[model samples]
Target: MSEAYDLFVIGGGINGAGIARDAAGRGMKVLLVEKDDLASHTSSASTKLVHGGLRYLEQFEFRLVGESLREREVLLANAPHIIWPLRFVLPHVKGMRPKWMLQLGLAIYDRLGGKKTLPGSHRLDLRKAPHQAILQDSLKSGFEYADCWVEDSRLVVLTAMDAEARGATVLTRTECTALERHADSWTATLEGDGGKRTIEAACVVNAAGPWVDTVARTALGSGTPAHLRLVKGSHIIVPRAYPGDHAYIFQQPDKRIVFAIPYERDFTLIGTTDMLYEGDLDRVEISAEERAYLREAVTRYFRSGVTEEDIVSTYAGVRPLYEDKAASNSTVTRDYVFEVEAEGGAPILSVYGGKITTYRKLAEHALEKLAGHIDVPGEGWTADAPLPGGDMKDGDFAHFLWEASERHPWIPPEMLLRLARAYGTRLDIVVGEASSLEGLGEYLGGDLYEAELTYLATHEYARSAEDVLWRRSKLALHLPQDAILAVGAWFDARREAATP
Candidate 1:
């Protein structure tokens, strides 16, 4: 007989992973399946901020901004290792929104989420030390506020990890090919390396992100109307643009804002252009126009103008925003909307449009919606639960790093810092009992080692070199071409050895 589950979740992105985690903790027999790796699409392709969407305040999305702001605090406390506070410098332009309006918005933003640990918004003197050398001479003053920088893909992985640890089965690179809803249950056909299989689920949560509408159609017939306005957002990476740990937010003449954030220690991450996306969802890439737009966006604010040659790499992803018939793609609401269909059969709740910062709350609310149709036990509990390796003494990353350094004195400072930041209290698990550099097994260029790769395969569901270099750690940015090839070879050999 096919295995029966209480709930079946489609998509391994943040939303699906979060729901699975919450449901499992509530004693539901849960399973989460993803067509690709976790966060391979929209979730991984964000501007990587856990902010309240300061720009959305202009559109009067006060509720969304406030909820997101509050969730930012919750996420930071739960996953301190992967999420941290980042200060942003928003310079006031000559013809842009007035300084008074900016100040008022900042003041509202500071209070909207209630009292928090992060420092409140404050005024900045652009004529001062760091800003004078980095920004243009024409920029006199601006505002500085607190947001957060998140390891986008890592956050998804850790959430899924937590879910798995709580007894939720997570199957990556597996696609849900068919969904047959009966009067009281769903028979889902999943295909992957293990081949096809059917499982019975009492309820379904469609958290397929960009494929939400498609999944809905698969379950509710082809005529189910689409609800998503695919908005393509792109970003460009370049060598360090400035010296400070702070990021810059530049205002465009079109009323949109662009960010240039310090990324991966040695690179500046600048992005995000919003355009109506109508092309392929599987392979999303930055258009030439988007690349130019981002370069020009930053050029107008910084002393050192960005050019085509300055761009080292670029990425783009589609935001499956809920269609509100907004005038512009940039102005569409980011708040999540749920479509529940339980009239004739078991309930299949489809999720639309939400940001990473609000994913936890989205899960709780999703379960609440399900509770009306089915029996759901337990109240919301993920708000205070720490994700894998996120627990530390008072959530102090620096103090944890210091203790790690004392224990692993032989490890290089740069390597230790990276490991500490990525793994938090789980650093020992990656390094094992290695006493010296050679104890980490074969070195894979940069600071990567075979031991870390083994840990990922054994515990983190990593199956390819791209999964390790790009999504898991971004080591591709630092490793040489030959070393990268070697990593691929290692995976190929491992797979071949397991083939028998």
Candidate 2:
């Protein structure tokens, strides 16, 4: 007989993690299972902004924009280390959106959201040095607005960490093969490396992301009236296009907007083409057309002219948007919708079409939808609580970095900063009283050390070298091919040593 949990969340993306964390904090016995690594899909492949969706306002998605804008502040307050304010430079192209229209839109955006800590929008002189030197000569004006940059994947991991700390069971690389509904509960069969197990739960949350429909049809064995529009969005990483910390949001002649963001300290991240995705879900890749489209989008504004050869790496993800019957893929609503179906008293809530910016609110609403069916001991509490290492004193990242340096004087400044930014107050756990770099164990490569790898494996659910090198940290971009190979060998050796 398996122990019955109050809630079983199916998925490991931001929404599932957030829901698990929230439910656990509310005193509900929760279990969350992910089919793959956390945020291995859409959540990690975002433009990585915590903005109000300025473009969404053009489509009259005022409610979504307002909620997202408010959530930006909430997320920033809760996880200051991974979420911080970022300024955007929107260069005004001739015969595109008029300058007054841009200013009016920004003003409405500023007013729609409640009180904010980040600065409001204003005009920009693109003819100046940093802007003029990089942008095309014809672009002499622009608008600067406030948004935020996020460590998107880390946010998902931290949420899961918080859920675990709050006594929630989080299983990664585990698949929910089938779910049997009863008059009072659900018996779920979960398969993982350790093998299969049946877990009983009072309810289920199908936050399966791209596989939401499949989970509903196969696992739950229910066919409700709902459809998903899979849209593939691709991004390209190139050598830093300009010498500034700020990012650019350029308007194209086709009325679509593309962003050029500063990434990985030495690369400029440009993205995202929205095309109807009808291909295999597991094998999403950047198409040549998308690559060329993005290059042209950036080249139109930059004097240096972006080209295909400049691309260092590319990534593509399929967004599981709710079927809104919109005219085109890009116009599909980013707002989330929940379909809660209960048969024989066992409820399954399916999440559809959500953005990274509004995940917290989505979780809150999810719990609200489960109110009468499940017993929640407490009200919403995640908004005020910091996620895992995010509890820097007063949420001041700069002060936290300084304090980290003061405590671990032996650690290198660059390494210490990276650790501080990534782990915040949790740096000491990884350092583990190590007084020197040598004390941290063998240097893996680049900034990676053996001690850090151990910490990731044991704490952050990193199973493969790719998990640590790419998703956990962008070391894949920094480390040489040989170094990456060495890291993989180290993982294999570690697993062998652990084998009994």
| The best candidate in terms of TM-score | 1
TM-score, per-candidate, Cα-based: 0.99, 0.98
Worst 10 residues of 2 by lDDT: 218-227
Question: Residues 63-173, candidate 2, lDDT per residue (tens digit)?
Answer: 999999999998998899888888899988889999988999999999987999988899999998799899999999999999999999999999999999999998999
Question: Per-residue alpha-carbon lDDT of model 1 for 138-184, expressed as tens digits?
Answer: 99999999999999999999999989899999999899999999999
Question: lDDT (CA) for every model shown?
Answer: 0.93, 0.90
Clashes in predicted model 2: 0
For candidate 2, give the lDDT. 0.90
